[model samples]
Target: MARLPRLSVTDLPHLVLWQGHNRHAVFADDDDRQAFLALLTDAAAREGVELHAYALLDVSLWLLVTPRRVGALPRLMQGVGRTYVRRFNQRHGRTGTLWEGRYRATVLAPQELLAALVFLDHQPVRAGLASAPEDWAWSSHRHYAGAASLRALHAPAAWWGLGDTPFAREAAYRQRVHDGLPPEHERRLHEAAVKGWPLGDAQFLAALEAQTGRRARPARPGRPRKGGSKSVPKLS
Candidate 1:
C-alpha cells in the first residue's frame, strides 16, 4: 500500500520520535549527545520550532515541539538529522544513515498536552535508563522540574494550566512525574508515536484532517508494522 504524506497542521504541537537504524546506539558518548542537542537548538531557533520537552535515549529520542508555520517542523528535523548524521559519521568513523528514516510525529491535542509533556520527560525512566526522570540530564525533565534552568527549552502554553508562577508550575510538573503515568496512557502514547498517527480524540482527528487535507490517523486499521510509515521527504 502507498504511504500517506505527513500531515502539515500549522502551530500544533507534535510528539516526535526517531531511532537509530536497526536500533543501534546513535549516540556513542556524551559528546555525541551534546553535539546532537546543539544541532537541534540551532535548527529549532533558525526554523522557529519551539522545543518544549525532550528525552534523548541511547538508541532514540523523543521531542515535544510546535512549529510556528507550515514546513517549519520538517525543516528543523531535516537540518538536525542531516547535520548530525554527518558529524556522527565523521566523529565515530562510521558511514551511511544514522536514523531509521524520516522521524515519526503525532500531533497532540490541547487537552492531552500536559500528559504528553510528562510522557516525553518520563521516556528515560520508562526505558529503564534512569531511576527517576530528573536523573536523565539529557532530557527537559530537569528544566521543567526546576532542577536545571535551561532557557533554551520552553514550556508550552498548556503548561500554564499547572500554575501562574514558575515555582508553582515546576512543583506541579514535578509531582505529576513523581506520581508516574498510567500504564495504559503510556502504552497508547507509545503506539501513536511509533505509528506516526495523531494522538487525539476523534474530533481532533477530524479537525486535523480538515486543516491538512490528509488523514490524521493511520491509513491501515491494524498495528503499524516496523518500517511501515517511513517517509523521507526532500530535506531543505
Candidate 2:
C-alpha cells in the first residue's frame, strides 16, 4: 500500500520517533551523541522548530517539537538527518543509511502536551537504560528537572504554566514525571505515533480535519448501511 503524507500542521506540538536501520545502534559513544545533539539544535533553529523535549536511546530517538510553519518540521528533520548521517559515517568508517525509514510522528492537542512530555522523559527508564529520568544524560529531562540548562530548548506554555518560577516549575515537572503515565496512556501514545494518527478528543480531531483537510483519526469500520443517516463518524 502507498504511504500517507505526514500529517503536519503548523503551531501544534508533535511527537516524533526515528529509529536506526535494523535496530542497530545509532550513537556509538558520548561524542557521537553530542554531535547529533549539536546538529539537531542547529537544524531546529534554522527551520524555526521549537524543541520542547527529547530522548536519545541507543537505537532510536524521540522528540517533542512544535513547528512555526507548515514545512518547518520536515525541513528540520531532513537537515539534521542528512548532516548527522554524513558525519557519523565519516567518524565511524562505515557507510549506508542510518535511519530505518521515514520518521513516525503524530500531532498532539493542547491537553496532551504534559502527558507527552512525561512520556518522552520516561523513555530511558522504560527501556532499562536508566534507573530514573534524571540519570539519562542525553535527554532534555535534566534540563526540565532543573539539574541542567540547555539554551536551545524552548519550554512550551503548558510547562511554563506549571508554576510562577523556574524552580517551582522544575519541581512540579519532576514530581509529575515521578507520578508517571498510566499504562493505557503510554500504550495509546505509542500506537498513535507508530500509526501516524493525531491524538486528541473528538472536538480536537474535528477541528484539525477542518483546518487541514485531512483525516486526523481512523475512519469508522464497515461500509455505510443502506438508508442510514449521512452523519460524520465519531473518533473511537
Candidate 3:
C-alpha cells in the first residue's frame, strides 16, 4: 500500500517520535546525548519551529513542537536526523541506518496538548529509567517541573494554562505526572504517534480533514462482510 502523507499545517502543535532501528540504544553516553540535543536545538532555530516538550530515551525520542512555516517540521527533522546520525556513527565508529524509518508525527488537538506533554515527560518513568519525571536529565520535564532552566528554549503557551505563576504551573504539572495517565490514554498517544494519525476528538479530526483534504486517520481494520444480519445494517 502507498504511504499516507503527513498532515502538515502551520501554528499547530505536533507530537513527533522516532526510534533507533531494531530498538537499539541510540545514546551510548551523555556526550552522544549532548550531540543529538545540539543538533535538534540548532535545527529548530534554523527551521523556525518552537521546541516545547521533549524526552530522550534509550532507544527513542519524542518532541512536542509548533512550526512557524508549512514544512518547518520536515526540514527540522531532516537536518537533525542527518547531522545526528552522522555524528553518532563517527563517534561510535559504527554504521548502517540510524533510524527505523521517517519520524512519526501527529497533529495534537488543543485539549490534548498538555496530555501529550505530560506523556512525554512520563516516558522515563514508564521505561524504568527514573522513578519520577523530575529525575530525568534528558527531558524537558525538568524545565516544566522546575528542575532545570533552559534559557534558549521556551515552553508552549498551552503549558501556561496550568497556572498563572511559574511555580503554580510547575507544581500543577508535577501533580499531573504524579497522578499519572490511564493506560488507555497513554496507549492512544503512543498509537497515534506510531500511525501518524492526528490525536484529537471527532471535531478535531474533521477539522483537520477539512483543512488538509486528506484522511487524518487510519483505515478500518477489515473489509465489511457482504452479508451480515439482514435486519441490522453494518456500521462503517
Full-model lDDT for every candidate:
0.84, 0.92, 0.86
Off by over 4 Å in 1: 218-236
Q: List clash counts for every candidate, in order.
A: 0, 0, 0
lDDT of 2 by residue, 1-236 (tens): 57778998889999999999999998998899999999998888888899998999999999999999779999999889999999999999999999998999999998899999999999999889999999989899889889999999998899999999999999999999999999999999989999999999999999998999888877787777789967877655
lDDT for model 3: 0.86
Q: What is the C-alpha RMSD of each candidate to the true structure, in Å?
A: 7.0, 1.9, 3.1
Q: What TM-scores do the predictions have?
A: 0.90, 0.94, 0.92
Ranking by lDDT: 2, 3, 1
A best-first ranking of the candidates according to their TM-score comes to 2, 3, 1
Clashing pairs in 1: none
**lDDT by residue for model 1 (1-236), tens:** 77777654678888899999999988988898899899998889989998998889999999988888779999998889999999999988888988998899888887787898889888888788998888888999888888888778877887887898989998999899888789999888888778777888888888777787777765544554687765533211
Give the per-residue lDDT digits (tens) of candidate 3, residues 76-155: 99888988888889988999888988899988887888888889989988889998888889999888888889865667
Off by over 4 Å in 2: 224-236
The window of 10 residues in a row where model 1 has the poorest summed lDDT is: 227-236
Candidate 3 all-Cα RMSD: 3.1
Task: Give the number of the best model, judged by TM-score.
Answer: 2
